[model samples]
Target: MTALDNSPNKIPSVTLDDVDSSVYSLYEKREKIFTRSIEGFFQNVRLFTGWPLLLGYFLTPWIMIDGRQAILFDLAARKFHIFWLTFWPQDFGFLAWALMIAAFTLFFITTLLGRVWCGYTCPQTVWTAIFMWAEQVAEGERHQRINLQKAPWSLEKVFKRFTKHGMWMGFAALTGLTFVSYFYGVRALVTDVWHFKLADTALFWSVFFTIATYANAGWLREQVCLHMCPYARFQSAMLDEDTLVVSYDPQRGELRGPRKRNADPDTLGLGACIDCFLCVQVCPTGIDIRDGLQYECINCAICIDACDSIMAKMNYAPGLISYTTENKLAGRGRTWKRPKLVGYGLAVILMITLFSYSLFTRMPLELDIMRNRGELYHEVADGLIRNTYLVKIINMDRKTHTYQLALSGLPAPRMVPDARIVAPAGEVVELSIDVLVDPDKLIEVNTEIEFRVETDDSLWYATSESRYLGPEPIRSQNND
Candidate 1:
């Protein structure tokens, strides 16, 4: 209707053109994914593996050894107790090595199986699956639930929604409580919580974890797997064409047009694919593996199971989609003996060896020594010299121990009247001792002395070298 609109070759205003253009159109509102359930080898494996891991996390802390939590990271005391071994802050190198091993192991597994960890054992995936199971129990299956959601609110709908969310929140709190129980003894935590005596830090973290679990697993769901997990972003770098992943065999599934129920592939000039789309229905992450290797594919293989079931019903061979590598599917030679795997294997072995060696050779006791600089050497009232030294001993054990101090290369070091020292299971004990070495025996201003502490068991020993101070020896004039 305007003059510009009437002109055949009129140019549009820059602002008008820019307003119409976009780098990307507004994203379509996402459809909620409703994944169907499937049972198969991989599904069973994931289920069974997840249980033991979950049980270990929730149960290990309560296990006691020598009347103490068996695997406690007593941060308050700066000690880590694992079974019989106790790691103090001084044994931090092994912890670093252990972390390196874990990182490399993740990389190695990623390169071999391609997100198997994410699909099967990841806490996010497992928890989300559990939460969804609860949802499915409360609401009906996929299509029914969708219809229920689209329907107007009613008493039945409200009850179902409230029940589902209420159960989810309760489970989240239990998970949070289990997590915190690892730090605080589970029995103490339970009693303290019931009595309203839980520490602020403990209560704060429990609530934080509860809300996070509820949101991530119940509300956020696949969004966490897709957008929040950094692993999904970096997994591409760790994967190669040879890595086994859940893949759709395009060659065997091309020209996938629908046909008669019993249509023969040879007669119809079609590949084996029947285009049932069951593979798409069972994917928790809501991705189509048929689009080729995608970061969104968690290698869950539920799609493979669904396809296999359909294939069986159609009298066709299974594996139209399967746990396969791009190289193998592309007709390339497959070899599991790649150099990268071998290198990772060697590195894993080396790290394990180093970690074991460090643990085995760890000293049972630690010693620290410092000469009293507050007051330099004090001379006695006679022809004698005395030096003060402060010594601290740490007992790295699950039980208490007593240590007797000794000194060599010095005349005698006496405990000032009552200087006996005893260290608890994981404590540091310090003492001050004075050494009286005869001035006649002094050959130099500073004489070296060896200090030692021996535990009653004779299995632990610590030693350090310090110096005793005295007047410098006078040299006689040279005979000429």
Candidate 2:
């Protein structure tokens, strides 16, 4: 509608007057949702379950184990330390197994309960719930919030918005700082934050996570689950007809109407539902359960709580909306004997077993042999074949270790700098050495040789296999 008129005379340029504006659009405006608060058994359950997760997230990094943070993923050092075990890049298999197990477990849960994790335990849901609670505290209840939203800018509206956003930002900052504490030590993080001494990487990530949390939990809210989350897209593949989801029993609730107290359904020709629209008001994603099963449903059951309360006040039976399977809603029986559930459970179990076995048997030492490829073999001063190898030793332990290298599968070989090599804890130490073997020991060229690196205390040993270059056997050449 407007453009810069930079010339001497004002003129209209780059006009879209000939195009129909309704035919195409790159942006869809979002409708603001003001979800009403409701209370029920599921609400209480979420409250109790969510607190532990929030507390654990905020508290775990502060715990000290063996003079170090209990749980830390030190990217700078390329180490991940759990409560009792430390993982290195070499132990990537364990991380793989853990991820597989988590995936299978999610599949199993989705097949049985249908997005219960999203409802009860997802970070997005939990944080959004808390943010909404803070909003309620600052701006009052549902109608009050709606009124304030439509109210013209005033001192009261500014005060309420400022208070609500202040709480949101405070919580988001704490969340970001807690995430950073999982990598940086908690005490150090606190001191650095207090003194403004945080490293650049830490500060950058802190600000990034702060903005991410604020945007996701405060502004985007349900849009993140409805549009952005990949899990919502694939959940239909994981669901089954027998999967229990928060559903409205249309058989019992349809032909819905409102009636006076002590009204008889038979005479009124109406179902139990009062058609109050409370379910819509209470829904976080703002979808009607009467619209049939939808991917937008997160199974939060807040609408169920609203319906049940309304039913109670009307002296009717509860469970007009409840966790029910499609099969059950269709007047069919639901069986627990599902092949998909069994398969997912089995996969999860198998992955867990493999992960446990690998974890318990993991070694904290690594040895790699890097041969000098510039020259294969050369004659030393005394008619000996000399092969140079760089042995890379990484000590993935908590303490220093003195390790010695030895050659095997080759007869009478001398290693230069035969003294034991010292490896500092959590550090990679490379030692360049030469292997000098008598020419008489060369049965064939490219003979297999094993380098064994063992600790002086006989506690740990690692072996790497490489080829030793030598002259071809004289007998082989004669036969050729």
Candidate 3:
């Protein structure tokens, strides 16, 4: 065999066209979506729901309850205040239970009604709706926005763009401030913002959330649901043929063609679809519902409203696009007794019950008793055995409590100082306790002891167990 030339200098130079260009490509360019404005039943429903949700989010932090913020997280102090209830780090189990209940509830709702949460109640959707409304106010309709985007930059365009972006930024900042107020008190946050005195950590979170809101709601609107949200990826597992979803009726809308408003669609071999493309225009995700269910579809039902309006004007029956089930569209009956749905419902109910029981049975006080480790035991005058303990009492109640401490599992134990201790509401108090026992009663190297704390009113009580250290018991010298 002839040896091939192996030297780099002997190789001919390669042209740019010789290389495959596709290998260099990293991502597809994003197309801006110009969502058209349309008003219908679903739009009205969204408006009604969105207003109340926004009001609750903005007003909740400012509301005062029992001389404190109604919903303060107080992370620095490891305390959470929800209206009248206070939660400490030890009560984190309740928070975990609440989260589990919320997850199961979402699963149950998805199994029954599809992505209603995504369409109406999701933070992304709600904020996007608000941002879109602001855009409409500043930039006219979808066609106008498209034309403006293509047109050369002018004074009017600059003004409109500036105004729209300013409004979006302001709203995003407000949202961020409100969110942070849940962890930091609203009044304090407001003062800090007004004076530009926000702490570094608070400022970082504020700016971080503000940028997130601005990007997700104003710019990344539909892309967030399509690409970022993990729920969109796994929602199919939670769905079944009987679940209600935004679906297009191909059986009724096929043979699609344009026709006169007064013409009979049957005579022209056309279905109810007028081919106006209004549904595609109004869709936030820029998807055609007639193409069938897609993961990108948020089940917002705007297509249903759009199709229904067109059908009314064309003198045709509505429901060419609607909230329906796959089974219903396939001419089959649907029942709610499907195993998956039942299982999800049961899980949700069980979690809710557990959360309720935990909340109701939560104690209003906590206690901890730690034996002093430095010295095991001390022998004072008259051969008395003395043990020192560090006692911690937490008052979870809303009122100050004067707790009376007592010892158990010992006979006539003498306690130094008064046993009465005072603890403020939602405060932890640590005390040094010394217990003196008669040497005659020393029978073991370590003795189990219980500490009890009772409120002055006797309405609340807490207890803790600890070991009392002592010298080894001495057998009678006569036996030795």
lDDT agreement with native, every candidate: 0.80, 0.88, 0.87
- Expressed as tens digits, the lDDT of each residue in 1-480 for candidate 1 is 344322221122334355545453576445577767677777888889788888888788879888888887777778888889888888898799999999788888988988989998889888988898898889977656766767899999999999999989998998998888877778888999999999998999899999999999998878888889998999788777788888888888887766776678878988878766677777887777788888888887888888888778878889999998879998998887877777777888899888888788787689888999876577788866778888989988767898878888865554453344689977888877877767665667777888888887778789999888877653322222
Model 3: how far residue 109 lies from native, Å: 0.7
Cα TM-score per model = 0.88, 0.90, 0.93
Tell me how far the alpha carbon of residue 459 in candidate 3 is from the true structure, in angstroms, after superposition.
Answer: 3.4
Give the runs in model 3 whose Cα sits over 4 Å from its true position.
Answer: 1-26, 475-479
Model 3: colliding residue pairs: none
**Residue 140 Cα positional deviation in candidate 3, in Å, after optimal superposition:** 1.4
Candidate with the greatest TM-score versus the true structure: 3
Give the runs in model 1 whose Cα sits over 4 Å from its true position. 1-31, 408-421, 443-450, 465-480
In angstroms, the error of model 1 at 142 is 0.9
Overlapping backbone residue pairs in candidate 2 total 0
lDDT of 2 by residue, 270-371 (tens): 998877778887888878888889998999989889899998888888999999999998999988789988889888888888888877777789999999
Structure candidate 1, residue pairs in collision: none
Q: What is the Cα root-mean-square deviation between model 3 and the actual structure?
A: 9.1
